[model samples]
Target chain A: MNLSRTARALLWAALAGGLGVVYVPLLIVLLNSVNADRTFGWPPPGFTMRWWAAAWESGGVRDALVTSLQAAVGATAIALLLGTMAAFAVQRYSFFGRESVSLLIVLPIALPGIVTGIALNNAFRTVLEPFGVSLGLFTVIVGHATFCVVTVFNNVLARLRRLGASIEEASADLGADTFTTFRLVTFPMMRSALLAGGLLAFALSFDEIIVTTFTAGAGVRTLPIWIFENLFRPNQAPVVNVVAAALIILSVVPIYVAQRISGVEATTH
Target chain B: MFWFMPDQEAAVRLIGLRKSFGPVEAVSGIDLEIADGEFFAMLGPSGSGKTTVLRMIAGFESPTAGMVELGGVDVTRLAPFERDVNTVFQDYALFPHMSVLDNVEYGLRVKKVPRSERRERALAALGSVRLDGFERRRPSQLSGGQRQRVALARALVNRPRVLLLDEPLGALDLKLREEMQVELKSIQREVGITFLFVTHDQEEALTMSDRVAVFDQGRIEQVGTPAEVYERPATPFVASFVGTSNLISGDAAHAVLGKGGTYSVRPEKLRLSDLDAAVGADEHSATGTVAEVVYAGPATRFVVDLDVGGRLVALQQNLQVSSMEVTELRGSRVRLVWNRRHEFAIAS
Candidate 1:
C-alpha cells in the first residue's frame, strides 16, 4: 500500500525496460528508414527518405505486394465463409466425431506453422499433383485458407457461444427460413467478429512465409517472401528494412482496428 | 393474419416429449398444451427441467422422443425459425453489436420484410413496450429491466404466436423482478400471444400465470391453477414447494377421517386455547412452547416446540393479532389455532 520514491522509481524503470525491449527495434526501423548513414544504430547521423523511394522503385517488391494482397483477400474471404459455417456446426449442433472435427479445425492454430506447411506440401505433392492439380495462386489460397480458418473460426465461434439461441429462435418464430435467420439474427450478431476475423486472416496471409514457401509456384512471390529473399542476401537492404517497416505499419493498423472491432473484453472462453 | 397473428390457439402442444443429454434426462415425457393468449408458467427449482421443455418448443433443442405441435401443426422436426415461436432468454441475448432498433427488427429483416416496413413495425413494437425512444441505443446501454423489455419487444415485434420467456425477470433485483412480473403479465395480455413462462420463483408463478406446472426431477409433479396447486397440492413435493407449511407427524390411520392423501394440517388451522387446558392431556392437540418468534413486519412468524411432536412454524398475519398481543416477546407458549379445511392432504 505504501512505497518510497526509490521503490516507485524502480517499478517505473522495470516497466520502461520491458517496453524498450520491443520499442527499440520499432524505433530502429523508423530511424533507419530515414537514416542517410548505413548502420542500424540508436542515434542517426543524418536523415533521408531515399530507402523508402528505393523500396518503392523495386518491381519485385511492388509485384509481390500485389500478389500478397490478392492472395490474402481471396483466402480471407473463403476462410470467413467456411470457418463461419464450421463454427456454427460445431457450436450449435451435436453429432458423431464432433471431438475429432473440433481437433482438426483447431490443429492449424495449435500446431507449429512449419509443421502445417510441411504437411500441406506433402498432401499437395503426393495427392493433388498426381491428379494434375496446379501449384500457384490456387494452391497458395488453399494454404492460406487452412491457417486463416483458425482465426475466422475462433472469432465467429466465440461470438456465437456468447450470444444466446433466443435471438435465432425469435427470428425463426418470426417466420424466417434457415438462410433468413442466418442473415438476420446470426449474421448481424457475428458481423463485427467476422469483419475482424477476415481482416486478421488477411493479415496472416500477407505475412505468412513458411506455408507460402511450400505452396507458392513459379513467379508467385509474396511481399514477405521478397523481404525474406532480399534480407537473406543482404546488400544495403536497409531498403528491405524500410519495406519491413512499411509492412509492420500496415499489419499493426488493421490488427488494432480488428481488436477494437471484435470488442472481446479478455479471453475468448 | 390479423396484425400478423400467425393464427390459432392451443398455440403449442407437447405430446410425450422427452429429451436427454447422454445419460441425463433433462425433460422426461412431458405432455403440455398452452392455449393462445394464456400465460402458463413452469415453476421449479434449478435442474428441474423446466428450461429444457422451453428449449424444445423453441427448436433450440429437439426432443429425443415425441412430437411438438404449434397451431395443430406438427413442428417436431421444424427448425427454430420454422416454428412460429419467439423466446426471451434469461440473459436477454440482444445482439450486442446492433442498435436497439436493429436487435428488435432482426426477426423481421430475416423474413426479408422491406426495410421501410421493418423499420415501421419495429418502432411500433418498441412503442408497445414503452421503449419507443430507445431505437438507436445498444443493449449494453439499457438498464437490466430495460434490456429485458427490449428482448420482449424484439420477440414480440415479429408477432410470433407463442412467446417463450425463460425466467425473463430472473436477472433483475427483487424489487425489479416484482415490477417486471406485473409488466410481463400486462405485456402478454396486450399482445394476446401465448406465453409459456418459466421460472423457479413460486410467488411469481402464483401472481402471473393462468396455470402453474410444478416440476421435480424432470417430471411434472402437479399442474393446475395457482389456487389448486397452492391450496390443494397433490404431492408432498408440491405442498412443501409452493409455500411454507408446518408438518405435524401422526399415525397415518388416525390422522384422517377416512383413507386419504398424507394427512397434514396448516399452522393457522390448529386449535389451541383455554379449551385445550380444560380438555384431557391426551388430546390430539399437543402442547407447544414458543421457541422463537420473529416480527416480520407484515406478519409474526413463530417457531413453536411441541412437547408430543417436534418443532413447527406458524405465520400469523399482524392484521389478525391485535387481541393476541403479538408484541408479547419470545419463549411464550401461545396457542396455534386454525380450521381443518385449511389443511391440504399431500402424499407421504
Candidate 2:
C-alpha cells in the first residue's frame, strides 16, 4: 500500500511537472499584462487595467484584429468544405491514387509550416503574377487552408471509418439519394468532429505567424504581425502583453468547446 | 394514397443475379422470386452469400450478371436510394444522432411527404414497434432491444414492398432474439408485406419464415417450408445443418442401404420400447453405457456411449411421473436404437 501510494504520488508529480513547464510561461505573460509596472517584475508589484485599455485603443490593433478574424474564419470554412468532401471521396470509394491523395492532404500539415508558407509565397509570385492577384487575405487564407485541410480531413475520415458503410446503405435502401443520405445520416453523425476540426483550423489560422509573415504582403497585417511589429516599442510592451493575454483567452474557448463536445478524454472507439 | 398502391404481383424478384468483388464471387448466379406478402428467409452460415443476395436485391450492391426487378420492373442498374426497398441491418444501423421519430421520419422527408403527415406516419410506425413514447430519445440512449425496434420502425415506416432483414436480431441476447423472432413473425403477419430475411441461425430461420432457402457455398441447398425442410432435408449438408442428428455408420444390406449410404437419426426419434433383433440386432446396433444426463426443464438430454460406435445423444420428454425408462446415470449399461422410418439416410 505504501509503495502504491508512493508510485501514485510520483505519477501525479511527474504529470504536474510536465504541464507546469508549458503553462507557467503563459501564466507569467497574463500576470505581466496586468502588472502596474511596465518593466517585468516577479509577484507583479500591483495589478492595473491600463495596458488592456491601451491595447483596445491602439490604432493598428483594431484593424488587424478584424482582418485576422476574417482570414481565420474564412480559412476554417473552406477547409471544412473541401477537406470533408475530399475525405469522404478518398475514404469511401476505391479510386486511383487514393493513397497519394490521402498522403497529399496530410503532407501540408506534416511538413514544417515554414516550408508550406515559402511554397505558397512562391506560387503566388510565379503562378498568380500573370493573373494580377497580389498576396493578401486570399494568399494567407490559401496558405493556412493548405495545412488546415489535414485537421478537418483527419477528424471527418476517422468518424467515417467508425460509421462504416451501413447507415448510408440503409438510407439509400429507404429510397434516399446520395445527397439526402449525406444530409440526414452522415452529416449528423459527423457534426461534432467537423465542428472540432473547424475550431482547430480557426485557431491555427488566427495565430499563424510564420506563414502569415511570408504571405501577408507589404500593406496587409494580421493581429500576430501587429503584435510582433509593436513588441519592440518600449511604450507599447504593456499593450502587446495585454493583447497577447486577450488572444490567449479568446483562443482557448474553441479548444474547451471541442473537448466538451467530443468528450475525447474517454478511450476512442 | 390507397389509390396509389400497386398490385399484389409487384413483389421483388431476382433473375440470374451474380456479384463479384474483384476476382472473388461473393454471390454467383442465383435466382429468387418473393411473392408480395411472403415471409421468405435466406438461411446460410457466414460467407454463404446470403447477405450479399439481400444487398444486391436492395440495390446496395449491383448484380454483375442478370437483373433485379420490383413490381416486375428492372432496377438492376438503379442506385440503392432509387429502389423502393428498406433493410433492417445486423447492427441495427440506427443513426446515433437522430431520435427514434427522426429516424422513422427520414424516409418520409426524403419522399417530400408533408411535415404533419410525416410526423403522424412516424408516430404510427413507432407505435407498431411499441416505441411510441421514445420519439425524443436518440438511438445511443436506447437499450439494445429498443434500438432494434427503432430500426424496425424506421424500415417499416417506408412501407417497402420487400423488407430485407440482414440478421437484424443477431446482436440481441438469446431470450430477446426468441422474443423478437415471435414479434417479427407477428409483425410480418400484421403488415402482410414481403420479407427477405437473412440469418445463419436455423432456429431463427425456421421460426419466422413461411419458406426458408438453405444456402451453402453460394448455392441454394434447399428451398422449402420449415416443416418440409425439417422432416425431409434434400441433401446431407441440409440434413446435418438443419437439425441435430446422431449419425450411425455401417455397411447395410442392399435392402437397408436402399435408404441411403449414411444413416442418421434425430435424438428424439430413438426408440427404446423394444429390443427387437430386426432393429437392434443388425450389424449397426449400438450398445453403450449412459455417459451424461442434462435436465433441460421440459426435456432430458442423455449422452449414451455406444459400445459398437461413438457416443449417441438421446433426448426424452420430461414428465412428472415415470411413463417409461426416462434416463439412466453414468456408467449404466444401455442399448440405444431407432427404427428405419425415424432414420434419415444421406447420400454421403
Candidate 3:
C-alpha cells in the first residue's frame, strides 16, 4: 500500500484542482450577490445587501420559488413510491426481462435531459392536447420525476441487495406472515436508504433547468428557469446571483441530514 | 426422564415425500416418523437432501409428490407461518434492526400476545440461552456464538410443536460447536419438543442426536440410533460417512478376510504390529508395509500398502506409545490384524 511522495503529491494536487473547479463558480456567484458595483466587475468596488433585499421583495422570485418547491415535492413523492416498489420487484423476484426492466427504469436518467425533455414535451402535448389539457406545474413535475426515479431506485436496490431475504424468511418461520415481516423487519431496515434516496431525488428535481424549460408552459417558471432567464438581464443579474447563493446555502441542510441519517444506519446496523 | 406424554402423537411424519427443482430431485422419496419429544437429526453431505426434508417439515418447501404431517395433520401445502414449526437457520438470521429481546419476541408479537407477556417470555427464553442481559443489545453487537444463541432463543420462544435446526452450529468454531451441541441437546430435552436437526458434521449428529437418518443423493441410506448408525452402518455411504472405514472390496476382501464381496472395517478396529509379530490364531490378518504414520495425539493411524493389492488404514490408541514410537513405524513391514467378526459385509 505504499505510495511514493510524488504520487501522493500528484493525488492531492488533483483533488485540490477538482475542488477549485467545482467551487470557484459558486464562490463567484456568492461574491457577485453582494457586489456593490452594478456591472459585477472582476473585483468588487465594495459589498452591499441590496441584491438580497431586491430578490426578497421580487414577486417573480417568490412565485418561482413556490413553483420549484411544488414541483420538487410532487416529483420526489411519486419517485419514492414508484422507485421503492420497482426496487423490491427487481430485488426480490425473478421474472422475464428483469434485467431489461432495471435498465429501462434507469434509462430516463441516463438519457440526456434535453432528449427526455423534448420527448416528454412532445408526448404531453400530443396526448393531452386532444383532451384539452395544457402543460403546467403537473407536466414539469412529471418531467422531473422521470429522471428522479433513477436516484431513488439505485439507493433502494443497493439497500435491498445488502438486506438479504434470510431475515425475512426467518420472520416467516417464526410465525409472522409476509406482510407482518415487511412491516416489522424490512421497513425499519430500509428506512434510511429511502430517506437518502428521497433527499437526492428532491435535490435533483429542485435545481433542474433543461427539462423544466421544455415541460413548463407559459407562466409556469421554476426557480432554475427564472434564474436562467434573469441571469442575462441587466437589472436582475445580481438578484440571480443572490438566488443561486441562497440555493447553495439552503441545499446544505438536506445533504447534511442525509449524511447523518445514513451515517447512523451504518454504525448501528 | 420420560418426557413423552401418553396422549402425544408423532411430532413429524413424512409420507413418501419427494421434492424436485425442474430436473434436479433434491429429495427423491423420504418416509420418516419422528416420535414426540425426540431429538432427531438428518445427517448428510451437501446436496444430500437432508435440509430439504427439514424445510418441507417447516413448511418452507412443498414436496413435489408426498405429504408432510405435523402432529398427525397434513401440512405439506401450508405456508410457513401457518405451520406449527419454527427454524433456527444456519446463518442465525437475527434481525439486525431489532434488539435481542425484540428478535425473540417477534413470533409472540405476531401471535398477538400482550406486550408485557411477550417481554417476559422473551426474557425467560434469553435466560435459558444464557443471554438474559443482552436483551437490549442489537444482534450485530453480539459475538458469533451469542448471536447463535439468540437465534435459538428466538425459535424456542415460539414454543412450536417442532423446532427445525439447519446446521445451527456450523458457523461456530470447534470448541464452541462442541459446547453448543451439549447445550442444544439439553435444551431440547428440557422443552420436550421434537427437534428435526439437519447437519453435515457427522460428529455433531453422532453426539447430539437420539436418532439419525443418513442421506445420500436424495435418498435415505439408513436410519438408527447414533451407536447403531456408526458401529452398524446399514449402507456403504453410511459406513464411510459416519466414520473412517477401510472399504476392502473384491480381491482385497477375499485376501484379507476370505470374503468374496465388499466389507468395511473401521480404522480403529484394526491392530498393527511389526511384520514378524505373532497374531492371534482367530484374528483376520493382512500383511503390508507401513506407507505412512499419522500422529493424531490420542490415536496413531498407519497407512499400510497391503500385499493383497490395496491400502488399509489401521488406527492404534496411543495408550503407552510416544510420538517417536509411532513415527518409527513408518516404512516398516507390518501385519494388520482385526477380529474376523469386526468385518461387516457392505451390500453394494
Best by lDDT: 3
Model 2: pairs clashing at backbone N, Cα or C within 3 Å = none
**Ranking of candidates on DockQ, top first:** 3, 2, 1
Task: Please report the candidate that would top TM-score against the real structure.
Answer: 3
Candidate with top DockQ is: 3
Record all residue pairs in model 1 with backbone atoms less than 3 Å apart, i.e. clashing. A172-B81, A173-B85, B268-B338, B269-B338, B269-B339, B270-B337, B270-B338
For candidate 1, write residues B83-196 as lDDT tens digits. Answer: 778889888877776799988888887778999999999999889888979999977788998999998988898788788899988899999888888888888888888899
For model 3, name the residue pairs that clash: none
- Candidate 2 per-residue C-alpha lDDT over B169-238 given as tens digits, one digit per residue, 9 for 90 to 100: 9999999998999999899899988888999999998988989999987788888999888877777788
Candidate 3 lDDT tens digits, A167-259: 888989988888998899899888899999899888889899999999999989999889988878888888998999988876767778877
Candidate 2 wrongly placed segments (more than 4 Å) = A1-16, A41-47, A96-100, A118-136, A264-269, B1-10, B245-263, B272-313, B316-336, B344-348
Candidate 2, residue B261: Cα displacement in angstroms equals: 3.3
Query: Comparing candidate 1 with candidate 2, which one achieves the higher TM-score?
Result: 2
Interface DockQ of candidate 3: 0.79
Instruction: Grade the docking of candidate 1.
Output: acceptable
TM-score of every model? 0.83, 0.86, 0.94
Candidate 3 is graded, for docking, as: medium
Which residue runs of candidate 3 sit more than 4 Å off their true CA positions?
Answer: A1-14, A41-48, B1-6
Candidate 3, after superposition: displacement of residue A251 in Å? 3.4
lDDT of all the models against the reference?
Answer: 0.81, 0.82, 0.90
Indicate the residue-level lDDT of B52 in model 2.
90
